[model samples]
Target: MPVLRAPEVRRPGRGDPAVGHRQAAPPPDARAVRRRRGPDGRRAMSEIVFLFPGQGAQHPGMARELFGREPVFTEILEEFFELLDGEGKRLRDDWLTDDPAVPLDEGRRAQPLLFILGYALARTLETRGVRPGVLLGHSIGELAAAAFAGVFDLPAAARLMEARSLALDGSPSGGMLAVGATPEELTRFVDPPGRPGGVVVGAVNAPRQTVLAGPEPRLGEVERALEDAGTPGRRVPALQAFHSPAMAEAAEVFTAAFAKEELRRPSLRIQSTRTARAVRPDEATDPGFWAGQVAGAVLFWPALEALLAEGDFTLVEVGPGRRLSTPARRHPAVRSGRSTVIPMLPSTAEGTWEFWTAALDALDALP
Candidate 1:
């Protein structure tokens, strides 16, 4: 495939986050990207990508204020909830209310909550004529992307979520830690053979950032060791260790259950984090692929590179928190002047119209 890179313009001044990124200045052929025009002389929105984040990105009472502020958002969310049964309803209540019995961070609750919010936001964006050119998801987020891509019907996706959550949440509990080191430095901890089974790099989020998952005891050792060496690792808020052998048992059960669900050819392009690049539409719905995603490492950095390398794409992080957007902005290949990182419902959203309007203006995906 040919590479398409956006033009590098001077980043915004100091106090701006864009200055820290290292963008490549586009070569001669990139000039046409500026002159490309539609029949009516309007700029076409052919490169806007929707980014969906997985676990650890949700916030407390995330949608509490969202209901009254954006009616369209409320409409879509309510419709989505209507499709769920009792368990889904209870989880939704706990997620939107100020304080509730079931914790939003519960492994079972977090996956579906993020999926619901992410899908609802995608629908709301569609109402405003902002459709995604491609979809990229991290781990469980792929299910939502597949749903939006029409790879599976909505009900099938919901059922898959419920079953997959049960499989993972009921498995042996584990832990995850975010290390502030590159993969080369991380080799000593994850690559050494004959060690306890739980420890391995879960996801390579960026060139300098990686998340490790395994038994809590072994993870603690790695965390303390990294800190002792002057590079501290932060504990990820997770109930179980994912993307490691710790999840292998659960993955087998999930794969068996999910295989019964029907899958159709996708309507849109999907770039999976499991492979860290775009694959054929059929590969997206493979039961084995979904199963492997549970136990395999998430190649997020390379997947992100694939998206950024395709010029003129604005990464609109559709779900809660700017976790994915933060790293994309800091990636070396990103050109902040053209391709930008936008968060639809950031931590500061607080369910307000003014904030959303500002976010849309920032996105600037439309002519």
Candidate 2:
């Protein structure tokens, strides 16, 4: 229930594409539309997808209390530290407290730690009889989702995450920004001269929340232009320009990492960004697909569209921040109809265990 504050850091400096602008315009309607009733006058049966948020969603003290209370949680944490810390030193200190010396903010520590914590939280929820019918994840969170869907064991996921973080270290300095426009409008905004180094739409999050990633200067210009145009926007605190061409090196590293690890078929369905299709663990193991994911925009829109087509689906956003859930709740199928979306992280005064119990009860209560 504690509100963890981000460390005070300066905004990144200018780079690559030069800045530009335009006059303010009306903001796009970012609200979710409700679905009208069908001819049968009955709502459809609902399914569920366990959604995971990535990277910036992590905070310093996430799951520290949970680790203290649960031995299983502690075991997982220790295992993660062991895998990451080849020197056999404790990595727990970096995550458990707010000490600045450990530098939990770095991509190397942040990615693996987030994955372990997310997995622990998902396991905790499962202990309370809460399980998703399907799994989906955004960005790095996809690793956790793959594990949850039984694509790989926790150890394999941990190694993959560590390799991913290391591969991304010292990469180019491009960034991502969430835009408040329809995908079409945003595409125009990021096109040709409007973009620097040819900024690409990274993720089509929702009807109104598409993310654009590219050179830092170009991204800054786009942000300023959006604000000046009366379109509310914010920069996602991401180190590398993920899902952009800039990540090709990281993708290659990820491919090698996966090739070294033994991958098995997933027990549950995994929605892949590379193929925009439901893939099994074995299929996901294709080095090309894993590598392609780094260079490709997350097909979150397709994943969501697939879920909606299933008619009824309860969506649970697991982990510290609410990035995934925020955009997902705005979907017409999830908002105006039978589906339910909830966060597993403790965002309120109530303890997470309490929240987990309530979420299970709510799921049970769902028709």
lDDT of each: 0.71, 0.65
Worst 10 residues of 2 by lDDT: 25-34
**Model 2 lDDT tens row, 1-367:** 2223323222211120111121222111111111223556543444557887775676666655455445555566667677766621434555655664445645666677777777777776677566777778777777787777666787777678777877877567777788777767875567553233557788877767778877666677877877878886777767667777667777887888888876667777777654567885557667666556766788787788876776777777777756677777788876665565666555432244444434444444433
**lDDT, model 1, position 204:** 89
Worst 10 residues of 1 by lDDT: 1-10
Question: Residue 37: error of model 1 in Å?
Answer: 12
In model 1, what lDDT does residue 140 have?
73
lDDT of 1 by residue, 8-78 (tens): 32223212243232232322113333444568876654477888888888777564445544556676566
Measured against the true structure, the TM-scores of the candidates, in listed sequence, are 0.83, 0.78
Candidate 1, residue 217: the lDDT equals 69
Candidate 1 displacement at residue 76 in angstroms? 3.5
